[model samples]
Target: MNNEITDSGVATGLAKILADVAGRLAAAPLSARDPLHVPAVATADARVRGMVLRGVDTTRWTLRFHTDSRAPKARIIETQSAVGVLFYDREARVQIRCQGTGAVVRDGAEVDAAWEAATAFARRCYLGLAPGAVTGRPSSGLPDWVEGVRPTEEQLLPARRNFAILSVTVDEIDWFTLAHTGHRRAVFRRDDGWRGEWIAP
Candidate 1:
């Protein structure tokens, strides 16, 4: 936490920070090698989980991820849309705190469009018996047919029962950078066409 500070310099600094993180996200397919891959997502209940970086829509200032329809995350989003998304670029010592509202799109146009755009590799996760299922075994609980490979599009059509899109509409962003000399922190809000301020770190 820090004191109130606002200036053009703060705005520019914030943009550069955001752009840096956005650039890392743009290099997606989200591999372990990527600077930013798994982001921490928090629900209204304070449940925090890590999810892959699905896609970043700068045009709409939204972030997308796919999850099981029956998962708690989906129901949480349905009731309380407020969510917190965190992205960290360890090498750069930068962390982004995204404050947004999330919506679970199941069979709607948005989900249909996103499902179509999802690569076979990405869509493979949903082709399972159930998400977060408990079995006596220590595995994903997916059957052999849909395991270890991308199911054919025909095989995947039925997987829609579990597939859902998590769309987060970002409204506020807090960015921080750590340096040897000191630290910098800034916040940007969408209200009134984007306003930002710098605060002591």
Candidate 2:
């Protein structure tokens, strides 16, 4: 996600590998806009929805993604903060699963700062009239301007009201690697101050 979550030693190394794998897949050829390249986010009600990997904050042990406040997953977090995110890249044979507390930020210093960092393309994601909106017709329901042309920063401004940052403050991380020689598995936890272990695959 944003700049690859630079870090150090084991933690940094592992995060970098995961980021690289996800990046490759996310960058693969597809439509102008595709959610297939994104990872999955699990809500409290057992709903697993796709979401782009917006950013990763390794220092804070949190993963970030942008979404509409009206989205079902967004509502689920308001009541149940527990959330899970899964990242898997078949080509790289790596899977990164994280369980964490969910936080919905609509307006705040963090939100503003994050929004500011978003590129025009990134901000374009929020161009919909309403994410998860019910419509009588079959369509993406995104505003017309988004499909025809790149909305200017001014046009993208209204999205701020609907834009939300779903930040996952990870408490645990399960990493698995599938390999012919030998599979590797590990678990990292924030409990008792950041504990890690090599577990059986």
Candidate 3:
């Protein structure tokens, strides 16, 4: 996820749509660090939240994200695995919707690696109170002592337990683009070997 892949520029074929989707998704985690890197992840219960894109494996069509194991969405995903991800590149005028099954892995080699890769400052979040926990007032949930400071290794020990990795296996992709002349749209399904079909925009 290090190499930046820029837009390939105006494309109009189904094959191009598939290739574009793959290329964008593959590079999202590595390069685009704003809106594209923070796609909206929706669960079965109609809950949606922006999550940082951690990695993408186009060969397997799987997306990786980091989440707190104590978060309610983590529990929801553990039970109802069906999920959808929406990615939009406003500058490129393209939107990609992905349907898939998600899993929250609280402990494993993958989880461990993700946690270890996170900066001490980034890892400080897991050390905070559980997400959605009712607080007396608006709060970051982080301890005052750790605020604006990177925690040491010893301070990050407990946070590791709350760290988890979310992996989504994409099954379908709907690609769309807006333009002055006309809009283009297409769909690709894993069940059909990812063969894309142009659809009415």
Best by lDDT: 3
| True-vs-predicted CA distance for residue 129, candidate 1, Å | 3.0
TM-score for candidate 2: 0.73
Q: How does model 1 score by TM-score?
A: 0.83
RMSD list, candidates in order: 4.1, 6.4, 5.1
The local lDDT score (0 to 100) that residue 104 gets in candidate 3 is 91
Over 4 Å off in model 1, which ranges?
1-11, 28-32, 119-124, 148-150
Clashing pairs in 2: none
When 1 and 2 are scored with lDDT, the better candidate is 1
Q: What lDDT tens digits, residue by residue, belong to model 3 across residues 47-117?
A: 99999899989878899999999988989999999999999999999999999999998888888888888
What residue pairs clash in candidate 3, if any at all?
1-30
| Cα lDDT for residue 158, candidate 1 | 74
Which scores greater on lDDT, model 1 or model 3? Answer: 3
Q: What is the lDDT of residue 158 in candidate 2?
A: 84
Candidate 2: stretches off by over 4 Å: 1-37, 119-127, 143-155
